[model samples]
Target: MKNRRLSNLKYEITKNKSTLLAIIFLTLIILISIFAFLIPMDPSATNTSNILKPPSASHIFGTDELGRDYFVRTIYGGRGSLIVGVLAMIISTSIGVAIGTISGYFGGWVDNLIMRSVDVISSIPWMILVTVISIFLKPGLQAIIIVIGLFSWMETARLVRAETLSIKEREYVLYANSIGETSWRIITRHIIPSVFPTIIIAATSSIAGAIMTESALSFLGLGIQPPTASWGNLLQNAQSNLQSSPYMAILPGILIVFTIYSFNKVGNVLRVYLEPKVAER
Candidate 1:
């Protein structure tokens, strides 16, 4: 049956090394996000007595300048980062997939208009755009997510559009069209499914970019406000004490590096597995 074929395709995709890695990375992050909520330590609690204490039996990651446990803050910080990343990805991918689907499937003036708009948006420097937006809006998690999501969609749009165009030209697509299937039906049932693998790949890749953007925004003091505990904001606070307390900056920096690296590794694996030549080989 059609359902069985679709299930098999999904199994093959999931069996891919890249897909497995991505799944693991995403799963770990999700679990961490959940754990942040369950932990006992107060992310914002400040105890001057415990300030700058090195990692010890009581406070594993040590306390910050404000005497808040770094471990607790890091976990709480992951909440914001992961939430923003997920929200931004949802927004970017939705907009990208929709615009790309419409443009590629319909083509003609629609394609020209969509692509031209994308080019115009893409020409702007993302960081500058984010900076401008941050200046006007309150510096917070939601604002950063919105700004990054808005600017990051161009790449996804371009990638999805290209995939859609190719899928629309496939023999199965042509056969469906020849059989007088409705345009919407063909696009939804056939075109979208065909391009989904590419979209998944692009979305995974974009998460790393989003995390970095959020960090940059936080580092510039235009990102998440004080007491929010983003990795970027943590680094911003540590800049003044980097010489005396290098551990302050190093901890968050290492987390950001590891997080981005994990996502990139997963994305690379997915890319390789999804390629036709790799499958052929």
Candidate 2:
């Protein structure tokens, strides 16, 4: 099953050159982030003479006001940025899947109550909510993860709930119920698998959202604090220096664009791949 799935995924990627390129580029970025330590110079190392230098042989991306290497900062920044995004995605997805499963698998006062709660949470302006929450939670990695994860799960929940509603009415579901299978077993064995495509597609977009949110919060001085490098914080520091050293902002900005665009493209690809009707068109 795993091999067959891999084969299908390979075929799907081959069918779309853009998606393949996204995968390859993203893979390279991720590899750099993973092996960031391999880079010769430390990202945080300060050199008074090298500060504000343009992109060159020794310092590829350039240098910041603090004389820190922009290339190293950008590469190392990917680690924290991607980790937070991925972590937030996992937390949100887990909470969403659990709540959605319960809300969807069991319809009644349970669904109504849970769904109403979801409505309340989802109705608020998300960024304002995040800011308000950040004020109390303080700015850091864990706090950012929790806030983003908690708030962002609503979309996934709704999707999962809707998918569950449709799936529970299927013939196999009724058969499982008729055979006296436990609710947990039925949801775990049957329903969850059916809804996984929705989750995967949702997840691709959600990670990108998380990355943006984290960057925004950090940029506003409400997320990852200084001395720590995230794409967002890197951009934050670059703002004041934009006129004098535009590359400070430009490099990280380009990276953020590349990363987010890749994720979005990957999400669209997954959506088409999972939906046979869409893929046909």
Candidate 3:
């Protein structure tokens, strides 16, 4: 499996150099996030002497309005963005898998009830729903994560349900059912594993979505909040200084775009290789 994974990755990289570059850059970003504590720069500490400084020898990415280091803040901000992205993805994927598994495996009144709920939720504009929810709740990491997770699971639920419905009809699943395997056991042990590829595709897509949503919310002053460094909040803070300190906006903006593009490329690779339909296409 390990060798196969490497070979597959090598093939993917050879096929799309963008995917290769994306992986390298994303790996560097993740490493930076992990090792941000060791970096000797402060995001919140103000330095009026260096205010509005452009990219220079001392401050490579320059300084912001409060004279804080943009380079360090951008690096540290990645940690938060990645954390929220990962946490929201996990929460959404968990809820989606559970609801989809139950609805697909049972396929009765339970399915109807859950599917109806999904329909109702899907009927609403997702962004409006999330914005409204954020407005009702306090704007912070926790609130944003919960809102993104809750609102984003619908599509994953639908995908998982479809995959489960197809997988549950297979001979192995029917045999397991005949041998007196409990519904829960069969669903957990058999159905979930079968639909895992679909789940992964959903998950990969969700990471970028979560990051973008968080950024949009923060840009609107509804996510992560000030003083705390996040890509979104950084962008928010920089909006006023676009003319004087364009690096403040450009740095974070580039990071966000690059990160999303990387994930998308990686996800595309996963979709083509892991998904049979995609492979056929």
List of clashing residue pairs for candidate 3: none
Off by over 4 Å in 3: 1-6, 272-277
Q: What digit string (tens of lDDT, one per residue) describes model 1 on residues 1-281?
A: 45654554466557656556656766776798787877877899999998888889999888889999988888777777777777888888888888888889999999999999999988888777877886788889889888888788888888888888888888999999999999999988998887776887778767877888888889898888888988888889888877767888888888788787777666555554455333321
lDDT of each: 0.80, 0.87, 0.87
**Alpha-carbon deviation at 62 in model 3, angstroms:** 0.9
Clashing pairs in 2: none
lDDT of 2 by residue, 1-281 (tens): 55655555677689878788888889998999999998788888899998799989988888888899888888888888999899999999998998998999999999999999999988999879977887798788888888998889998999999999999999999999999999999999999999988899889888999999888888888888867789999999988988888888887788888888899888877766565444432
Per-model TM-score, in order, reads 0.86, 0.92, 0.93
Clashing pairs in 1: 18-269, 18-270
Among all windows of ten consecutive residues in candidate 3, which has the lowest summed lDDT?
272-281
Q: How close is candidate 1 to the true structure, as a TM-score?
A: 0.86
* Candidate 3 local lDDT, residue 24: 93
Q: Model 3 lDDT vs. the true structure?
A: 0.87
**Error of model 1, residue 136, in angstroms:** 4.0
